[model samples]
Target: MAIISLEYYSEVLGMNREVKVIYPEQNKVENFTGKEIPVLYLLHGMSGNENSWINRSGIDRLIRKTNLAIVMPSTDLGFYINTTYGMNYFDAIALELPKVIHNFFPNLSTKREKNFIAGLSMGGYGAFRLALGTNTFSYAASLSGVLTFNGMEEHFDDNPAYWGGLFGTMENFKGSENEILPLAARFEGERPKLYAWCGKQDLLYSGNEYVANELKKMNYDLTYETADGIHEWYYWTRKIETVFEWLPINYIKEERAF
Candidate 1:
């Protein structure tokens, strides 16, 4: 596998951004014919950047034998939303990022069936938001995501500037496009298959359950799971492989030298 740190200017974000891409080595694939490869748009949590997943999840080692490309983008603390402070991170990820990726690597497939999204914590929310808000990804997964903000006031109440810049205020978040439940409800196109996993002891467990139940009521194809874990990288690193396994793609296995 080839791990590339690509830095480029994002016209959407109006600034230079860096993305980490994990691409399958073409020379390693048996009978290689330069076919289009499936892609997983992996996102990071609130306190992470593009390098979070690759550095912490052991994803590079786990998927070394699979013919899949992973794109990891940094969105700061925007929570993958079109922030009230005028940053269009949601558009950057949902729309511009793919075009950027495809422009750079033409072999990465653009079809919905070949595209997937997943993340941990804040990024888990981003995965659902991007998938439900747009028809780009065929599958979406979340690991201990903050699916709802119904009771998260205490977490941000003291930091008004931080919270205000992201959403204006907690009151403004409800029923807004930033909230996942409303996005799922208002979405009118094909629904992406959804997978959500949160630890039984996680602080966000109730929020995940609430959102999962609501999505079930809305007739969404969602898979929700819970086990002994927490909101840490150890839990995410183990579950990310499961997310890949849950995706509807056949892995092209290649023999490794090591």
Candidate 2:
């Protein structure tokens, strides 16, 4: 596997951004040749950059056997939304980033079924938002995601300016494009398969449960799981392996020496 740290200028964001890419080495795996590899657009939690998944979760080692390419982008605290403050982060992730990746690595497949997205905490919200809001990814996973804003006032109340910048006041948030629940309900056409995992003891558990129930009512292809865990790297690092297992991809067998 080849791990590359890519730095490039983004036309959508109007700035340079860094993305960590994990690509499979074709010759290292058995029976892999001349085929486009599936890609996973992995996202990080709040305050995490492109290096979070690799540095925190040991993702590089986990997917060493799989013939998959992973693209991890840094979005600061943008929540992967278009943002009320004029940053079109949603467009960046949903549209521009893919084009950028494909241009750089033409071997990565662009088909809906070959594309996937997943994230943790705020990024968990981002994964669903992107999947439901657009028809790009065929699958998505959320780990300890903040699926709803039901009782999150206390967390945002501490920093009104920060919250307002992202959503432009909580009053207009519910039915807006930034909201995930409404998107899930109102989405039309083909829906991406969804997977969500939240620890029972985590603060976001109730929200995850609520959203999972709502998806069930809507008959979304969703798989929700829970266990004893808290909102931290330890839980995410462990659960991400399960996320990989849940993805609908054929794992490449590692070549063994005789």
Candidate 3:
């Protein structure tokens, strides 16, 4: 597996940006086939760089076992939001970044089943926010995520004005407890598969379970699990490996093809 770091300008955030990419190198791997590999947009928590996944989580190797393209973009302090006064980081990610990647790489499929999103901490929140709000992504996951309302206070404590701007009001955060599932009613997607898990020992456990329980009540197909762990990269790397297994990557079927 070879990792590529891309730097460029983006219209969504309206500034210079960089993203770290992990993919099987067609030049080195015979089976690489130079096809458009599936994409998994992994996000970072607040105050993190695109390098977080590789630098902290060590994802380059584990995913080499699968035919997935991992792209990690850097958003300094934006909290992955389209704020009233802050950069529209979410739009840049959910819309612009995918287009950019698809244009530069071989696209295996544009179907929702081929796309995925996952992250941790603030990125976890953004992951579900996009996976639920947008139709493009099919599979989504969050590790040690802030799964439910940590309350407007903690949300604001990070970026008071930004949170207030996108949501409009703290009240808007209320019904969101019902919105964390990756599936939306009458989903505009292929009814994308959902994956959300957090460490039982993490402080976010309560919130994660809150969203998971709510998803159960909604009759949504959710893969929500709590395990013994903590909120750190030590666990994220391993968790990501499991997430790849949970996703329906065709490589497995092809390997077991009768």
lDDT per residue as tens, model 3, 1-258: 669888878987677788888876665444665665778889898778898888776577565556777888866666566655667877888789888877666554566777888888888877877787788888888877766655436665587676676554666655542235433543564555677888888888888887878777767678987789988787787777778888777432112111
Best prediction by TM-score: 2
Q: What are the models' TM-scores?
A: 0.94, 0.95, 0.85
- Poorest lDDT segment (10 consecutive residues) of candidate 2: 249-258
RMSD of every prediction: 2.3, 2.8, 4.6
lDDT at 35, model 2: 68
Candidate 1 CA-lDDT value:
0.88
Model 2, 1-258: lDDT tens per residue?
889999999899899999999998767656676367889999999989999999887787777768889999988999999877889999999999999999999989999999999999999999999999999999999999989998887656788788888987778787887788789889988899999999999999999999999899999999999999999999898777777788887664333221
Per-residue C-alpha lDDT of model 1 across residues 1-258, encoded as one tens digit per residue: 899999999888899999999998867655445567889999999889999987786788888767789999989999998998889999999999999999999999999999999999999999999998899999999999989988888756889898889888778887988889998999987889999999988999999999999999999999999998878898898788788788876554333333
**Model 3 CA deviation exceeding 4 Å by range:** 27-30, 150-169, 176-189, 250-258
lDDT of each: 0.88, 0.89, 0.73
| Clashes per candidate, residues 3 or more apart or on different chains | 0, 0, 1
Model 2 lDDT on a 0 to 1 scale: 0.89
